[model samples]
Target: MGQVLFYKDLWKEEFWENPWELGGLIVIGLFTVTFLFFILFAVLFGLLFPSEQTENEE
Candidate 1:
């Protein structure tokens, strides 16, 4: 007999029975993590180096 694959819940549980779905999940997860880090660093940089407004002096 052949083995049957199924889509498992990643949030509630661990391990993926299907390779195709697991690959998709991994790719999406990586992209999500990258975006999260990018946003975090952007906010930190903005706060640390805020632009200043100045008027012309005589």
Candidate 2:
């Protein structure tokens, strides 16, 4: 039995030669950075201004 391969050579010149792949990679990178930035901002905001909950109200 032979094993199937699904991974491609990301560092290969051929990989970067495809405009579609390059564009997809750029989009993915931007999305990841934006997601991380939002998460960090939320965390900082929460830490800086935390909500106060009193036991008097449910």
- Candidate with top lDDT is 2
Q: How many residue pairs clash in each candidate?
A: 0, 0
Model 1: lDDT equals: 0.77
Residue-by-residue lDDT tens digits, candidate 1, 1-58: 1222333344334546667779999999999999999999999999999978768633
Ten-residue segment with the worst summed lDDT in candidate 2? 1-10
TM-score of each: 0.60, 0.66
Q: Give stretches of model 2 more than 4 Å off.
A: 1-11, 53-58
Candidate 2's residue-wise lDDT over 1-58, tens digit each?
1222334444466788989999999999999999999999999999999988899867
Cα-based lDDT for every prediction:
0.77, 0.85
Model 1 residue 56 CA deviation in Å: 5.9
Error of 2 at 1 (Å): 21
